[model samples]
Target: MFTSRERSLGKLVVERFRKRRAERINNLMVKEGAYWYDNFITRTSLLEGLSLLIPGLKFGEDVNDFRDLGNSNYRALLRALDKLDDHELQFFKTFINSHFYVCHATNNPAIATKKDMVLFSRRKLIEQDIKFNTYNTAYVDIAGLANDDNVFFSLEIGARPQKTIPGAGGSRFGNTYYKVAYTDPSFDFSSLYLFDQALMDIPQCKISDISEEAKAILNSRKYTRKSICFYGRKSLPALALSIISATRLLPERDRLVLLGCRTEKEKKRTAALSF
Candidate 1:
């Protein structure tokens, strides 16, 4: 397994710093306004400070969509950030980007309330630690087997979600969509993860050390810290992966890439494509 911390931070290249600024900016998305009313901003001037100190960081031109976020919260976020000095801004940036929030739903998949999202994220992280460490360090969401309409009916009300216990073939099918985010406060998994930390980031893992054989067997080379698809939005690519990617995941394209790189670590299909 590899992480951002293992990656080289040599010379503090401007490009890497740019990427960190991008990641920090993204984190602020969830910290503004009504979302803030619920999630709240624990780190006030963190982002503004990071933007000012980082040579490459600068706010982009006013965006049409970001405009929808209401100028007030954006301004509030910016104003709070304006209060910090350079060095303090650097510290705030570093500290704010280090934390990870899990995105999850409770027994309810229709809506992931903020409190429920928080709870689910925390518990899921601990659970993921166990599951990911198990299975030879492999984790799979085998939702394929659980994808029958009849199964849903049965599981929830018919016979699919039947057994209140673990066995299947019961009399009901239950709503089973779940999601969460997990993090390693220390970039112990990969050097790349660590570099992101230095840059004030929530770095994504690029690849793990699985054998080529394992890659060939699974027909996929990735696992994740979070996913693009949650609840009824499997069709929605992980928008947080990129501002553009989120726009794409809108109910528009069918050729969407699954946005489940788990924050940033990607599973590459190392083998060549064949007809």
Candidate 2:
């Protein structure tokens, strides 16, 4: 387990890294006569919340330009100017100043398509997670019925703080305990997904950037006599490729779903990076 200090430091490191990434995007935008929105949360979502605080602002627009949408951009920019306790307003400023730009683009999609893509992507990911969880639950239930063994599950990942021996100094009471070692219990069944929210929160510097300890736990998992699946429906090509490759040494029955795409019809024209 990581100490509170360690967790705080980790969060700080991630925030700094993301801020640097944001700055890089901002530089690119400035060079190209565009601006970068650096908010982790999307602008439209923030606008939806702000609509409750402020009035007479229309959320629906053909062009989706905040500045042209009856002074929404100006109002948000003004609020951020206060630099008061409004973090949302600060983020709103970032979003507005960026010209609502994300990455470099010559021809952005229509507002409807953009909104549809966002909504569809979120819904598909959630549906995939639900299916994976259902499979995991069913596998455990069958195993328990056969062997009468208890199974436990947790959606959380990462280390938690534990108190160690009392500290020798003032102000501090005890040493922060760290989980130096990890072990994968003889889980009747095990599974992993590359695009899980917890793993997605990690920066992509390297696999190690996430956690060496968590990786060790994953690497230690045995697939023999158990069902261990890996999902990658939402991973980028390079990431999906790497994750799929890692599954080669696992048990043969362990399922691995890499990137896939289909353009069936107008409603479900799916396109994604694949390996």
Candidate 3:
């Protein structure tokens, strides 16, 4: 038999434990959800930006085709780039830096008589940083899931699965499609308009891909008051731009710091972009 005071103390400990567990779970979910949204936005932005630059360029299908075109028409592309105005050139540069890895290699190293020439190379971008900001963020799935027919149906019928009506062949398996009817008061579907608004005010930058050395230099105490770490090699420019845009959604007192790392092994090599 436990005393009343002892029982009360046990109940308080259990409640505290439950509260801490819930907080941890919520934090994990927010982190995962933020990562998913970041990836989706970054990828979609790349595709949309590419489509604007190169017409008829479709994601997944036309990537190889575009690569071939770039390789075959390398000189022609350079000439075309030279013809672009200042604004157009800046946009093109930003697009390339965000979506591709620009590499430089020196050729004719063996020939003592011949001067070495530098060659420019472009490769697909990879290893984007995981996003950390999750507060007051809104993401709408403009491109919905491919196999969400059943999901929409369930939502329509108050989350209860519906039985298929028997056909002449006796309950033949067939695809059932349902148009999404946004009737849930809990979810604000009106926020979808914000996507279009963001597109209208996209910012352009003069430079992209801040060097690792420069990032390390910025990581010093002299440059940064506080820092938030991020991991990636490519897509830092896009991430920076996204962070800048998201600042409007944050409170004035809340500022963002971008710390870039190529790999987890070099996690100590940090950078900061204070705003």
Candidate 4:
């Protein structure tokens, strides 16, 4: 049997695979401006959390822009990385290597479909991780099951939660109603922002020294929905767009997901290029 430390590494390996693959898909979707990208997470059963403390952070052009979302998220990533302290980072390396880091079958000589692999197996690994951590600083509650049936998960995507940007009020007027209520092993869905503030953009960029056309283009943009109900009947393309877009940036190899381009042709043309 694997040691406790070894098992944590194993989970990271599995989570990382999906993340890497998702990044590839995100880049393609971004380039294509595909309508389906945002809806994936917004409409599906996927779960995500928001940091309540985010509203208090100061905001300005220096941080909240479309292109800068990645930069903002990078800051969040640094915070999460800092949270690791020295002990966590040292152990994280081993966890990355102890598993099937790569899905050889997807890249094999025969036919392929990554989305198929995700539905068939990849997603099962991520299982409720989206909702695992209800608070900014806390541990996730893993629903332990057998390895093949393993549903345990956590976020290692490395993006920090954006706490500086204002809501720019995603066009709605209401007091926030989401809360964990309580923390435990079982997961619960409630009111929350879909992703981090870094991923969500408040509509204020084009209003600056840009043309009316540019303002229209900026206004056209929207953030992903904060909550998704798989049991429901709505299709949230916008939410999925943000989630998938965010997913597309995961580290490579074991972190690949099924969302990326299924063909080599697609992969080569739209693969994400880190800046």
Candidate 5:
């Protein structure tokens, strides 16, 4: 088992890594003439397909043939993000990319209001902490199951989505997708931590205070302060991590004796593959 502190560190690491990765991908896509809000069919096809795959949003009627979102909430989101600095911009983008899956996963359209998109996107981070035991480890050959009619359903959605041959039960099947990201060197998870909001939001002025407090707590239990990373979640990735690693603030490490728990959950639903 790992401690909460350790788990938090691990999560922060992964969160930071993914954020950098997203920024890199975004820049690359832009360089290749891909914009997120553009009407370019092949470019925005992923979001378009998502709108179709999800239950609430209709193809043409609800979202203008998946080209334009009918709701003003997306515009509102753009406005909100427009005010952020580059550093905060990357952070927000990374944060949203991590939870954008939830937007489509919603079951109720009336309840799946535009506000719900942001709400679920923000809440999914905490939900991740409670659900999984993240580790600085790597996994290979990972596969999971999902249903065709479902939105980001878990791996245990039962049966294959479609059958290769026309048969009696072919219509009742679900889809089994492999975790290809795991195999990708760029999506490495070897140093990921159990994530929490605090790790992402902590301020620098409070770092020394927290470090002192942590030391006192550990000393009472015969533990010593080791190294600590005062990143506070704005840290950029290194060259080995991604091409955009140098775009953000560098990570800081401190020595402190941190304690936490490493929890383990059943391997029920595997990685989410909405592609």
Candidate 6:
């Protein structure tokens, strides 16, 4: 019923709309896949990636570490990593160094107790004349550290609760339950190395170094939904560092929240402290 010119214009509009729709669908799929990879598959992928990067590394003796073999998610992460160019790989390394923490707890009689006891940073270990075995380390994200409520609880109890342990089969290694703990606050802050070089340590801040400005920023309704990236030997110092770093690293619009703690005392301590 339309003129030829009108019909041509209608067809062009339809084509453009279809193209945009397709792009939107594709983007959605990509995002969903990324979410799956990050949440469900990243732990296995990280272990596998470390195995690939390090020639003779073994997670545990007499255990098949790659039990998640044939998993589609596992394969997908490896494929993605394999496709990265040198520059991309370097960027990935930088990202990992910035966002991840290496937890080194052990049951080795020479180094630590029969049950895993949380130790200080590498610098602290050296200062105390303790020898560490790097082969028996676990890599975890900083965000995970901020989210775990039981870190202090496990330390207080001297054993990780059964429910909180990583796998259903119980501790992976013999007599050693790997868990992160809140480090001692009394240690020298100058020597404290919470994370890699990408994250700078606040050399002078103690457990109670939080500023009023930082507290206000966190309490603001605008930032209520933001996830805080904590860094410190103890809770308040961690909170303070996260607030300080967020000003530079995170976007202005994002919120910053603290991780969970076990005790009312710890909570009260954090609440009472201000700089």
User: How accurate locally is residue 274 in candidate 4, as Cα lDDT from 0 to 100?
Assistant: 9
Candidate 2 lDDT score at position 99: 13
> Could you report the Cα RMSD, in angstroms, for every candidate shown?
23.2, 27.6, 27.1, 21.7, 22.1, 24.1
Question: Which regions of candidate 3 fall more than 4 Å away from where they truly are?
Answer: 34-275
Question: Which tens-of-lDDT digit does each residue in 1-275 have in candidate 5?
Answer: 99999999998887788657544432332222212223433224345444323333322211121112211333433443345444444433442223111111222222434543221222243454433222211111010001111122121222323223225432111222222222233333121111111112221122231245443432232100001111212111211111112112222121110111011111111111100
lDDT tens string, model 3, 139-248?
32111111111111111111222334335322122233222223322111111111112233222221134444433333332211001211112123323332333332
**What lDDT score goes with residue 92 in model 4?**
35
lDDT (C-alpha) at residue 120 in model 4: 22
For residues 1-275, what per-residue lDDT tens digits would candidate 1 score against the true structure? Answer: 54565444442454466445433443343222111211112133344333323343323332222223323333433444445444334433332243232221124233445644222222243454622222211111111111111111100111111134225432121224332223322111111111111123232322244434432433332222111112111111111222222213233221122222222222111100100
In model 1, the runs with Cα more than 4 Å from the true position are: 1-71, 80-83, 108-179, 182-275
Per-model TM-score versus the true fold: 0.18, 0.17, 0.18, 0.20, 0.21, 0.22
> lDDT of model 1 at residue 262?
22
In model 4, what is the error at residue 206, expressed in angstroms?
Answer: 28
The residue-by-residue lDDT of candidate 4 on 1-275, one tens digit each, is 99999999987776667545444433332332221123332233332221112222222122112222343443444443444423233333332222111111111122236523221222332463432222321221111110122121221111221112236522121222111112211222111123222234443432222345443443355543212211101112222233334323343321233233334332222221100
Computed on alpha carbons, the lDDT of every model, listed in order, comes to 0.25, 0.27, 0.27, 0.28, 0.25, 0.32
Can you write out model 2's per-residue Cα lDDT over 1-275, one digit (the tens) per residue? 99999999997787667445434432332222111121222134333333323333322212222112213322433343344223333322332222111111112221364453211121233554622223222322222112112122221212432223435321131132222111222111222223321112222222222244434434454321111112111112222233333433333333121111111221011111111
lDDT at 44 for candidate 5? 47
How big is the positional error of residue 193 in model 3, measured in Å on the Cα after superposition?
21
Per-prediction tally of clashes: 45, 3, 0, 27, 26, 1
Number of the top lDDT candidate: 6
Candidate 6 structure quality by residue, lDDT tens digits, 1-275: 99999999987787667445434432332232221122323235344344324433432322111112112223433443345444334433332223212232334432355663544443345577867553332332112111111111122222333332336533333344443433332221111212221122222322333454544543332211111212122333333333333333323332122222224443333322211
